[model samples]
Target: MSIVTGSLFALALAASPATPAPPKPATTTLAPGVTLLRGEFVPGRQPDGNTIVVDAPQGLIVFDTGRHAEHAQAVLDLAKARGKPIAAIVNSHWHLDHVGGNVKLRAAFPEAKVYATGAIDAALGGFLASYRRQLAQAIDMAASDPKKQDGYRAELALIDAGERLQPTERIAASGPRDIAGRRVELQVVAPAVTGGDLTLFDTVTRTLFAGDLVTLPAPLFDTACPARWSAALAALDASDFKRLVPGHGAPMPHEQLSQYRRAFDGLLACAASKRAAAECTAGWIADAGALIPDAEQAFARTLVDYYVGNVLRGDASRLEANCAAPNDLH
Candidate 1:
């Protein structure tokens, strides 16, 4: 399968029965100064990413704004409840699920400066343009069904009007940065999750905000470089962070991270050996152990298909090349 074929498959998947949108985001306190805004990414639904908020001495710092306006509002409410103004917003990657609420959040807190890896600009301009077109077609198909019309219309409006906020501070490289009186180490892992993947470590809380670099149940292999992604996971496993917050799942401990890494490694090895998609998927299923519950079997299979067809079968060099150059996906 090529990139074009993978993209078409993705669009076809999107046009299928709409997955249910997540309810209000739930909050989890990771540490004294760290709070996680957990969101859901149902395989076929309105997938929104997770957000992490840190209450520093100067003000509040947010990691990723989530996919929906309501999700972003939930984060804003949490910040208000903490009685700290949002001083900065750090986007982990260019995916809409991670950075969709950036514009609204920035409008709410004008003082908050947005930060992201510079490569996100190209993703927003290229890959996302194609994504928007596919999403519009999906919405149009859904609109014909009275039962799904309302939901599809709402999503369409969001796609048409939602602003893609540009990063005020483009991180050209990874290094230590001070935000709101707290020291943060930003690591830019390229051609992994996307062109520019920004992972953050909060020295104060000992937590790692791993964007799409690490996900539970199964990884979203869309627009990923398998080799680089595996390496990134290995680096995360070796890190000193006490807890890891993934882009779309619950916060994980080191043990869970290990499980994910093993599964990912198995899948990659199977693919690299010129195995069939079914073989790779089966290998991952075995390596994943009990992570895939009976109810989530369908979701797991979808992700596996995506990984094998999109990430594995596609040309690795082409994927890497497109990361630097603007994708003509549209």
Candidate 2:
């Protein structure tokens, strides 16, 4: 399926109470000094494609964990390669992908400390509440449709298998600190993508581990306030990072991040214009043919799908809204 179709399907699944449980976490190396670790509970893909790893001199640090325990084990393997124990595990946010490996990481590296923006802890708390509500409602939806009901049963099974991961710690974004032997600075910029979203900067490498704050094909509004997201991107634009890493997609220079920001702003403007003209469609996919061009069709459609089915519909708003810095969400 197309990225747009896939995203749309994910939305439908997320709301149906029968969405397949995510896969056990896994690991994959991204680039030198970077690893994309998977989470434990996410299904095949989407929403649960978390990337966790350590950086240079940053010693043992984690970016994010996939949705399952196995993914955490994958991280342990990577850490083992370093020939040293993990010093810290930082959750990008409260999302299952980013935080799923928390418990396992703690188990593997008993001495490692977990850190995250206070906002992430808050975000997780809200997600759990909302997720429970969504499941309850999804149960009813599934009951009405046999196919959906079967899926719901599968989800129930996954949950019963202890697939979901929740945060049990709290951390503060206490600015810059000495990670391993490296001196780095942490900044909680703006919550464009998610409420408590932020990034870490390595002054030495001039690299910024931007969470979901800077995404490719434009920032995913799957869980965002467009206007607020716009402001957040602008804030990022005003920042000083050169190299950047995103929660999804590969890493690139700041210019690439800018392109995403522009695309996001442009789309929001289009949405706002449509809203002002009183010609807005009831669905995100309705206007893709006209507003999104083919050259960048995949991304445009992805944005449309995420905005319409996820953001506009208020699917994960409260989770994003209540996230804070120095909070534990894994």
Candidate 3:
């Protein structure tokens, strides 16, 4: 089987027999000629862990390292074990979970060029500045609530310990780049997922690395503009890709992505309609948890929180007020 297909097989085997299943041998073939090393990060499974290392001809290219130097080391080890040299590292966005290992990766592969979109560069700038601001706040709050004081100190420590990921040094032009025998095409689908989210496409294997662009359990729109994100999902449907490697959850069929988009669009529409009628937060929304299947009700609550906290409060609302009607196309 091809490496891509093989990789899928390995993942499937690993996923099967959830309880007491014997560990499958560490097989590197995830597909034909392509190798995917599932890193320690799987979103929803863990808040701060999600990274994947890919082995291609050009060397090792990782998609989104977790939130610390140690995570990067783990990825490097897996790559080294497979006889793959660290070549380049890329982030799907600037979220701390995605880019936390930028400093470490650069240190490990100094020759490897880090790539991100202009928007991500700007976003990183904002992130660093925000970190600084948080530090200041932490310092100011040190004398307040004891719990708050501890939180502030921890936050500051994180900022100080993390390497400053400068954009110009670590960023790249937003487009396709050939890496280790694989044609990696990076496309910015929309502002959903995150302000300048991008997905990597492997033309050779027809695989698309959808960086948090599509997630399970109804996905997360708290950090992005839902309207734009919904639009982004629509665009992804039109784009060509056979296998999708999501930033979170298991690798999914293309249709699952579309299904997720439609669900989010539906939730947003319901939220907006209520808001327009001045009854946005009525009892129905309060009971939203009961409407969806128990499997998805939790994520649905997150959507409701966004509607209330962001849209209603006008705190970080990015999508204006309209929730476009959902369509069968997603």
Which candidate should be chosen as best, given TM-score against the real structure? 1
Model 1: clashing residue pairs?
A: none
Off by over 4 Å in 3: 1-46, 124-128, 135-175, 275-308, 311-313, 316-330
Q: Between prediction 1 and prediction 3, which has the larger lDDT? A: 1
Ten-residue stretch with the least lDDT total in model 3: 1-10
Candidate 1 runs further than 4 Å off:
1-21, 146-164, 315-330
Cα lDDT tens digits, model 3, 28-138, are 444665554443332122233245566677787777766544556667777667786777777777666577677777767777756655455444345445655655654
For model 2, how does the per-residue alpha-carbon lDDT over 1-330 read when each residue is reduced to its tens digit? 001112423544755443454554445555566566533222223354356465656467776655444556667777787786777766666555566566677766666665565554444345444454555666686666776766544434433333233323343444777666666776654354555655677676666777777544344554455666677667667778766777755566777666667666655665555353222222232333332334555544545555554455433434334222322322
Per-residue lDDT tens digits of candidate 1, residues 150-207? 5555544544543446678888677999988899999988768777789999998788
TM-score of each: 0.87, 0.68, 0.68
In terms of lDDT, model 3 sits at 0.54
Q: List the candidates ranked by TM-score, beginning with the highest.
A: 1, 3, 2
Model 1, position 169: C-alpha lDDT score: 86
For each candidate in turn, give its C-alpha RMSD to the true structure in angstroms.
3.7, 7.1, 11.1
What do the candidate models score in CA lDDT, each in turn? 0.75, 0.54, 0.54
